[model samples]
Target chain A: MGNEAFLAIGIFVFTYGFIIAEKIHRTIVAMIGGALMILFGIVSQHTAIEHIDFNTLGLLIGMMIIVSITAETGLFNFIAILAAKIVKGRPLALLIVFSLITAIGSSFLDNVTTVLLMVPVTFSIARQLKVTPIPFLTSEILMSNIGGTATMIGDPPNIMIGSSVKSLSFMDFISNLAPIIMVIIVVTVLLLLFIYRRQLHTTAEARARITDLDPGSEIVNRRLLIKSLLVLFLTITGFFLHQTLGIETATVALFGAFLLLLLTGENYLERALSKVEWTTIFFFVGLFVLVSGLVETGVITRFAQSVIDLTGGQLLPASFLILWMSAFASAFIDNIPFVATMIPVIQDMGNMGVRNLEPLWWSLALGACLGGNGMLIGASANLIVAGLSGKEGYPITFMKYMKIGLPVMILSIAISSAYIYLRYLL
Target chain B: MEKLFYMVNNELITLTEHRNENDFEFLIHTKTNEAADRLRKLREFFDSDRVYTDILFYARKDHEYQVIVRRDVYVPFVVHLLQLQLLKSVEWRTV
Candidate 1:
């Protein structure tokens, strides 16, 4: 009704339109919306930048550097090789091992890291086995989201969700959802085996083609490797000790990375810096400004209140409500920005006496994250993996990813929803 | 040791500062003495034949590198050396 509300609608409209047309990059679209919000005086410039969530950025950057070092060490490669060796050329066994390892990494770190660190290595093994790597990658990506479901720091959405709700913790992930996470992992592997069985290499020639086949490797620098591993170990220790030591995750990670740079002794410091995707970071800054405008315009708060009333202050029904909407929204909207805006909506739901709606937070996080894999433009990790795959000569068209990704979305959401309902509600 | 030839743009590939673990001799198409010398040395290291007791170059075509692996064990060891070489070379070309 007010000028601010009008402006907010305009920003949202522009964001959606810009994204849909593909005329502007998402960072630019988000930046434009955020800039417009500030220009219209919907939110002050300070809040616009301030709301961008540097915690997420810091965690991501810190982890990327650490993961890069680990990747360079060929630890990930060695792990995949171990899986391949342990599977001993069994397609289904390799699928399970690969998926489980990827899920574990994704849960602790994030999907993009897990994927980046795992995919190429997976590709190498798949090449050796003379089989298609798609099923393994698909399962990995899906399991990544599902695996991220089990841990607070596993996914950005989970981190955001956890930070917004205090009843949850790093430990809570292991205690509350570990069983369900395991269930999803088992189901995911089984589903992948079934879905891709026909594609499995059974021909005698193809079978022979895989035995002791070639995938690339790197020259091992034991000094560099040991040094990098030390830094990584320290980083993990710092991360776990934070609650008692009263340290921040970002500070620990940043400091650890700095130490690694000092000790790595190679030119990888600069190379590593180049590896950080500032594009995604800027996108975050831009999206925050855009979402802040929506908040400033009072539209978001109003929307939140109405939704709260509609749910009759019941968290159980609200959990379902948020689940479906978040899933769909995630399919279309950028999950980071979506998660950013929903922080307030979640608070609004809380204010309406949705007691222990904390589990609802998990649903929102898992739903959006898993649902993000639904479409081409869902998650940052999706775009990254797609681009990486393409760079490696395996171009992943939107249609192709969606073919597998869509079914993955449906199954993951159903499983997650059932888990949340059973865990939280009657 | 064995030499496997992988000719990339007419210049033989070499991993300058890394240890060799494969027997590969190859010609790659490229212009640079460093590239040629590196390739030749790699071939010598990997070459089991020991054909060249003297220094000479073939008159035509491109540069070739000789790469040799120190031992024989499989599971993509040679592939690793090739990837590292390719990855470094590719990174160099791009930068």
Candidate 2:
């Protein structure tokens, strides 16, 4: 009815259309939309700038820099070669280890980056093993997403939610959710087994083939390895040390990145940063303004509150909606921006006295991260893997991915939902 | 003018078209002949919406080739199939 309301709605429609069409880069669309929202008075420039959480941006940039430089040290290649070699190119064995590494890595670092670093080496390993990397890669991404869900600094969505909720602290998240995540991981592995049962057995003399492929002899950089390991350890420790030492997560991450830069310097670091996907970062900044407009106009609060009243505080419908719908929605749209937008909606639901909304947050995290396996564009990891691997002649098609990923995602998310319902809400 | 079909003994899945900036690595998990056949078909026509079309073939390469492989193993293969040529472009699958 009101002009501001109409403007907000218009912004939403435009953004949705641009995202779906995808002819335009998502970050560009978001940036333009954000700028226009301010120009149209949907949000004041000051308020829009205020809504931009530089802490999240700084963390994303800082870690990206560190990851970019560290990955160049051949550490990622080293790990991938080891994972593949340990399995001796066995698909089942490879799946378990790759997923474990991805999940564990994502829990500390950004999930997409974790996925990105692993993609190239994983490809090399699969080539060596003479089996499809699809299953192994899928498990890694799924695990990364689920594992990333446990930590506050793991993904952009978690970072946004963590910063928004005053009562929610890093310790609270790890303590409350980590136990449940363990159950989630087991269920995830079982789902992988169930989903890719046939692929597991396809391991024919791929062992010799793996040795033949060589991946340039899996060069071991012990000194670079030691340095990368040190920075990563300090960064992970900084997550827990934040409250007491008063060191910001961004500071630690950037510090690690700086250490990498100092060691690797610009020549090597540029190559790594090229892989960082600043477009996604801009996508974040843009969505912040677009979503902030609704918050500015009091629309997000109103919508979230109204939904809470309709649910009568029942956890079932809200939970179902959060888990299933979020997963399905993420299939079409990029999950990072989508999840970033939902942080406020979930937080508002909490404000409306929805008890146990933490499970709801977990649900969103599960759907957004795992559903990425369902389609190509669902997650940055999928895209990065595509970009890096595509150069080598293996092209992952949209339909082909869905054939494997759809069944896997459906079962995995369902298993996760059941796990959450039984462990927390039930 | 120039097109070729090479069997990959490697696990990497690739899709390329004759024209178009859209390119990608596809994930293929064909457990049976039929499954492999279908994946070959899909990768062949993946870029129908894009510029040019090509034929494809699916065969297990007996060994690493004189050729080069450039895709990521762990990435979901579909994300980059936008540029894969169809199997029709290839005359046949060799050993």
lDDT string, candidate 2, A255-291, tens digits? 7777776775567666766767688778878888888
Model 2 C-alpha lDDT versus the unseen true structure: 0.66
lDDT of 2 by residue, B1-95 (tens): 43234343223333332321332223233334443444544533432322111221222333112111223311222222222321223322343
Off by over 4 Å in 2: A194-221, A262-276, A386-395, B1-95
TM-score of each: 0.77, 0.74
**Model 2 interface CAPRI class:** incorrect
Q: What is the DockQ of each candidate?
A: 0.04, 0.03
Chain B of candidate 2 achieves a TM-score of: 0.26
Angstrom error of the Cα, residue A189, model 1: value is 0.9
Worst 10 residues of 1 chain A by lDDT: A211-220
Q: For residues A230-281, write the lDDT of model 1, one tens digit per residue.
A: 9878987776666667655677778887889888766888888877777777
Best TM-score among the predictions, by candidate number: 1
